[model samples]
Target chain A: MSNPNMKLLYVVLALAILISILAPFLASSDPDGLESAAEKIIGEERFTELEEAEAAIDSPMPDYSIEGKGKLGEIIAICLGTIGILAISFGLGKIIKA
Target chain B: MHIPDSFMPLSQALIYWAIALPFIFMSLRWARRDMDEMKIPILAALSAGIFAIQALNIPIGMGTSGHMVGAALVAIIFGSPFAGVLVLTLVLLVQGIIFADGGITVMGANILNMGVISGSIGYYGFVALRKRNIDIKASAFIGAWLGLFISSIAAAIEMSLAGTFPLVPGIVAMGTFHFVIGIIGEGLITAIAIGAIAKARPDLVDDKAVEASKEVTL
Candidate 1:
């Protein structure tokens, strides 16, 4: 017999993935839910106040987006995030089965 | 919302990675018990749900906003499969890469605190509560609330360990903010999801019904 819930779960997961992957391009650049609040009370300068020298570190992949680093970090982030997730799921799936 | 590198110190981020490593190991073992090919889709959908939910970034006091962590939610819906971890991993990666919400170095830590703690510990707590004649609504409420609450404090402690903030203040702030966020978001989500699942698919909702106490054993 076929397992119905599993299939439904798959379709939902796919839809969620496409949305998340496109979130960067699709999302409004405006300050997010919390950022909007922060700007209201503290003004835009307040977020800046939180910044510290520790951010000055010369890491290649400093920010989340593929900023200074070439295609290398971008590939790593995407590949690792996706592949890593898959690997964990598959590998752990095996263990759980054992 | 993602915390940047500047606000949190390297020491704190490093410690997060350290803590996450072991959970990853433990999760692998947990997944081994009931590995089912059918559960993959549920896990994936859960990951996606987490992404969509985290995108909300609802406002809280102190010029901060908290979104749905849903770690416990994932665990409750789906077991300890890497799907919860994967879902959170993707969310953090996107936040770092696209939104600049969270930093790259500490991404693993964020996943551990939000994903692992909530999914594993919180879910297990829910299971334990479920073992007794606990009410479904209360169980869902406690599972999600405690999951986020505990994970947030754990994150704060991890930060303090890494010297992100002064120990006392860090705990006080992250804990307080998350407590509110968890109560509102986790409670609402868990309750609604439980209700919907119970109505639509009682079997899937696990412990949602009153007599669910001994109906099934996962």
Candidate 2:
């Protein structure tokens, strides 16, 4: 990559990190558009039931938070996920380039 | 929009996966052939940035919130809908496996809605508008908006097909909510991101359509 493009990547990475850290606090607690729509169609209780149904695999970081970690845990979880995605993408890019 | 596993029957999920595999293959081919070394880092940054932005859900009113899906932004930046598919597939995998933000079984449907459909519409829409001599920012905004809105409608249809939601009401609700979300979230964010990236790295953006527009205007 050129110097300018590298600089842009760094800037984007920094911004992404910042957003991940802040998201737990700033992000709305309300249901997202799809969730809200589902709730409207199926009723809130049924929607919740469906969302809570057992899945094939349980995620280590379910709902982007660690159990009993509160908001701080959420911040950590999301930030880690963000950084992990960066590393994964970078690695994938390198492998593809090679 | 991320559809949970329970919202889709196993059979329906399998069908979506079948439909999405070809697109995934094509995206991989594009990644190998079209994405050069210089663009790879940009792609990495974009994927990370998209994942981060998706974590933040800003309220769009009416008791709902939304985030940028980033499919349009990816397509427009890389100048290919395949790029959107590649990036979104990776992001969705991580989200499903680690964060559990989206479901594993229903992932195919999510990918189809947010990646293939949104990416195609967003890229083609922007190119179409730019070909008509429209401003870049305006084209991006409209394209992103249309991509998101239509994708949400598609999701509604999928949900209906899965028997999780009644058809017309599901469409009405999802359509209404995403229309508003598309305007305030996807459209604004895509336009801003495109503008910033173009300003910072003009050579990195695919501006052939812009050039074509200039030719037409001249």
Candidate 3:
């Protein structure tokens, strides 16, 4: 069994992950708060003013999570991130003496 | 924002990947000490704190909230070598998984740009500023701002290199959006967070974390 503290931390973090995952489904499609203000001042053209946003830097996946690869991708990302973190932490514990 | 695959040319992205390889090698090689398992709590808390802070939308005109990425604050709290990058990694993961703030495919590049660039560079910058005996809060504010500002440029360059944007327009576009991003959110948050850390957890900080105030005599 995981240490109680570790379990608690994991539970909290996991809940956050769940909420974050559901965010797109639940969140408003309205202009993000700041964007709304900027739109009021500069009009829709304002966001368009950025040269790259007009050109190529506007990646279609700009903010979209690549929701495909089904559940596999999401599960894999969490595992990889968790593993990466665990490895880094282990290495740091050895090195920095933190 | 994470620069997506669509943003980078294969050639330039490969170049960054190459650069990243040796850098990570050296960073891992250079490590000399160890941290504690308990410290993970610190990292998790710090990461969650950053997420919450970033969640607060500071209204910057033009339809966007410039969120604060706490690279600089984490650096100060954890020191550069070990704790710094870890915080960045956690923050990026949360952003990627939860908010879709960045795409998973481009996560490596985002880590390089946000975590590696700003977290590490900002750490050193705070040190340099402290050498002048600058107030720790001001030191943090400037370092955080500079870290985010320069990293924005680095992201722009990387994006341009990858052919994310047309040459002239890409850099210009990245610079304009991030310059504002740095000023309104990054600077203020850096100041506030650093101040809070200094006050609440002085024990967590390393003495040498911030650089000396003045040049020393041999």
Model-by-model lDDT, in order? 0.59, 0.90, 0.57
Calculate DockQ per candidate and list them: 0.20, 0.81, 0.14
Q: Candidate 1 — number of clashing residue pairs?
A: 10
How many steric overlaps are in each model, in order?
10, 0, 19
Q: Residue B150 deviation, candidate 3, in Å?
A: 0.8
Q: Write the per-residue lDDT of candidate 1 for residues B122-160, one digit (tens) a residue.
A: 677777777786766677788888888887777666655
Candidate 1: residue pairs that collide: A64-B96, A64-B97, A65-B97, A95-B32, A96-B31, A96-B32, A96-B33, B2-B101, B11-B162, B12-B162
Classified by CAPRI criteria, candidate 1 counts as incorrect
For each prediction in turn, the share of the native Cα contacts (below 8 Å between chains A and B) that it retains comes to 0.25, 0.76, 0.12
* Interface root mean square deviation per prediction: 5.7, 1.0, 7.6
Candidate 2 lDDT tens digits, B106-213: 899999999999988999999999888788889999999999999999998998899998999999999998999899889999999888877877777797766777
Highest lDDT scorer: 2
Question: What C-alpha lDDT does candidate 2 achieve relative to the native structure?
Answer: 0.90
Fold similarity of candidate 1's chain A to the true chain A, as a TM-score = 0.52
True contacts kept of 2: 0.76
TM-scores for all predictions: 0.68, 0.96, 0.66
